[model samples]
Target: MTSGPDPAEEHSADVAELLALVARQIDMRMPEIVREMRDLLASRIDDLGGDPQLVEMLQASIEGNVTTICHILANAIDLESLQPTTAAVEYAARLAQRDVPLSALTRAYYLGQSMFLRIGMDEAERLGVRDRVKIDVVRDIADVVHRYIDWILQLVTGVHEQERRRWWSTRAALNASIILKVLRGDSLPLRGFASETGYTLTQTHLGVMAWSDLDADDPARQHELDLLLRRLATAVHSPAPPLITVVDRSTAWAWFGGARLESDALARVEELVMAVPGVRVTLGEPGRDVGGFRRSHEQAAIARLVALSSPRYRDRTVVSYSDPQVALVQLLTKDSTTTATWVREVLGDYAAAGEHARVMRETVAAYYATDKNAVRAAERLGVHRNTVRQRVDKFEATLGARGVDPLQVALALRIYDDLILDGGDVLPS
Candidate 1:
């Protein structure tokens, strides 16, 4: 070297100096690179607030290398010589060691470039760059940017599926908790639960469903019913737990309960029942508390019976217990035989023969209406005082004289009228 530097040694020294210079430049640019990455990530994260999927994808991309990313960017900008700087090479090597995808890095690079271009475009315009140059840069940046966006979207979709599965698991657990409380007739402090579970508490909800069939022995039908119950639970929110019960297998008294259903929750439940082929479904009314839920379920059961008994009430997907006929049917069903017998005895043959039954029944109704005043009874019946007297006399005779006690007769007549009007198939004795 003292005589004359060896060619190989000289060349090696020059290469080392070039590599060191490149390393220094990369080190010097580290702050800017980190700042750019942070800004890009922040913007993307802000755009996807609380979106678990987007967060995961972005994280994956940041942990990846920039080789493929750099290649893609170079291709878009028509610059093939845009090799990775020392820092980028190091970053890629670290990511590869960690087993992260290089495509994720490419995605990050495009994202960073897009943000840079946006800021650069404004500065260039302020500095009065020519329109042609601005357009060319924008087009080049945009080409790569679109690819990056596509990559982000794809990554987000995958992440979303994963997040959805996680949320579904959480939801299933929450639902199970609520259902356990419901079975025990206990109320949940939903606000507290929501806070603990990190779920929105503003919208509270509940739902119910039921099923029935003629062939109770059909195992296939039972399996289908079980599947339907599971399907209903999942459809409302993914990975939901079963909230259904077969209250009475013989009568097909199946039921479901849950929270967070549509405003027309009952209708939605009925729609599910209707969709089930061959199986009869009855959707109960929607409600909040467990007690209210029980009432709604009872109503649905009554509605199903009414549908079976009367064609006029048939094929109704959602049977509201509030319907006049349905309510009457429920009332009669409470004590049908007793009610029928009472009706027959009160309005028997004698009362029907002389129209005394009608007069006395009307009189008693009016008396009760007027708080048991004979004067008011006569007035409302539009009959003479003695005419009302004659009718009362005939009623008393028919009711075995002892039964003519005005209070007793009045009570009986009232009960009879209620039973008959409510579709009790009973005639007066």
Candidate 2:
């Protein structure tokens, strides 16, 4: 032992000194390296790269991390003595606040670490150190970076999860969970949930689905929609504040308890709903008790689907389950292909996609809607009575060969209207 210096010790010291020199060189190029790292992370992680605010946070975090790693190599700092940078920790917390997936945050770190390791190795090689020295230095640098990432990742992951849990435990989030459970038809202790949400399940329920064409991730949009629902409840004279759950940033599901839009209030409610510039609302028919709660929400959901599918209702600010032929169309269009076939059989030539057939379908629909009064149908269609009579005669003559039932023909006409509204094939050839 006294006779010789240990070869392994000598190699380790050499690698350490070379790594320090390389780290200093890399430090000099920090701006370029930071740019490369930022580009790499942005290209790889959407949630990290998407928002300008998030991207700014990410840039700060990357700068802090890269600087820290350089200091670790050049100064021979003890890994255990290091703390995650404030920028890095704050970035992770911000991502959590926005409800970005934890896996995405963790993935950013691993990706950044890999890129950092590569930069270190490249710098070592560029220094023109001997092959053995380069290998040793690169290996040591890799170990240091791995340990640093592992340490920082643990801290950041913990921060993200803690923030997410804190966010989820907030009053609105808790209430949303309870409401979702009830909406899912879960057999919950109704009284407890009712008390917790300050909504009564025993009262009449008017379910509403409100949505807009906007980005779902914007908190401001969601807040606006929530305020809109509160204003709607006040307009409708609800006995209590409406219970609303944000279905997304752009959509909300609300229940107006103890309030039904009476005949007198219909005009006012419609006026208020239409005045809102960009939002669309679908209303379920009033139902009583828990059964009504589920039924009304289901009806609202169905109305939303049917409204979205129909060009007539698609742009309308308010679509109600009580609207003319909405329920009938919903029933018939449950099976579109079958409904198409039935319409073709019932209307015969009137189901054709040609303009002549289109007019016939419209005339017949108006005529049927107005109790088969040709005069009233003409008024509705903005056509002369004689024109209505002529179309009616043609319609009757076409269906006469099939010996159609009046009610069945009426239902088929409704489905055909929906098909045309959707701008799809009315019937297969």
Candidate 3:
């Protein structure tokens, strides 16, 4: 008697036939597949400074990466030594040379893998295989994909690191000068250099000022600062890799693009403060255009300056220019002489004294906000009204019997509360 088709043989046949169908159609579907990917990654095109050539090359490169996976699925190639292109390694090196951040470069790999998963699932459905065989094929493809991604990341990161050292060592000075020129708003055709640097001038920018009060002489610490900036970039979603200018060993200025700081980025930065020691950071609100770029940096400069001045705020890990007090301080005080003279004339002994003086400055500021209402000030301060009244009395006694105007005293106290700073990074670099 002749046996019907064997179950085991039938199952293997279905799986093989399904894989073959996908492989055949993968090439045919390349245009639609790649278009979907381009649509998903459209936001990133501008991050490459919106250059047509760079965007085109990035699209082509992603298509190549995806096509290699299609071949692997067809079983024509082993994933072992097969690279999508030697072009990836060369591209990594070229991006490094162009000052493109490693984070931004590798993001292309991640975005490709994401596209593969989404497009793969959709393509699997269209294969019209039996449900049982379809599940097995999808499961197996996913397993292999996870492994491929791990391998590819290691390969790309190793090459990128190797090239980055060479690039940074040679181009650090040139990059720094370019950053200075951009921030200074020195009239220059910045768009031409955008491709070379991978930083955009057309987008909104968030300025940052970071410094350490400790020693600046150590090159290692300076490198640590550089690493911190890179970490900050990754946290913020690579809004055009941070353009950093090292002012000295102790301080640096950096800018990242985006309309606002993402909450996760802010949260990650809070964590970073603990990881990187002795670092203080301040950020300006997002600003647009070339003039806005300079203004944003000024706001960051003001935030940094004010943070340094306030005894209460001295140990703060990060400050934002959006702080009303920071904005007020920046707008009201500009000259070093005027800044110092106003504080001395108003606060008297409190300007030079210890933490108690700092507390009194806060107490007085609250009092002003409350319109000299001791009860409201105490409520705002979470202290006893008597305590609020005593501080107010002491402030008035120090200011003298004639007494300064409540408005004037309030403004000076808030200024001191924000900073008793001497010529902070007030002047943007």
- Give per-model CA RMSD: 15.3, 13.0, 9.1
The digit string of per-residue lDDT tens for model 3 on 174-267 reads 6677777766667668675576566778888888888876667765566677778777767767645687776765888888876457777788
**What is the Cα-based TM-score of model 3?**
0.54
lDDT of each: 0.50, 0.81, 0.72
Per-residue lDDT of 25 in model 3: 79
TM-score for candidate 2: 0.55
Pick by TM-score: which candidate is best?
A: 2
Clashing pairs in 3: 309-419, 309-420, 310-419
Task: Give Cα distance to truth, residue 13, candidate 2, Å.
Answer: 69
Q: Write the per-residue lDDT of candidate 1 for residues 357-396, one digit (tens) a residue.
A: 5656776567667775667778888876677666656655
lDDT tens readout by residue for model 2, 351-408? 7777888888889889889988999999999999999999888788876756857798
Candidate 3, after superposition: displacement of residue 267 in Å? 4.0
Badly placed stretches (over 4 Å) of model 2 are 1-169, 366-389, 422-429
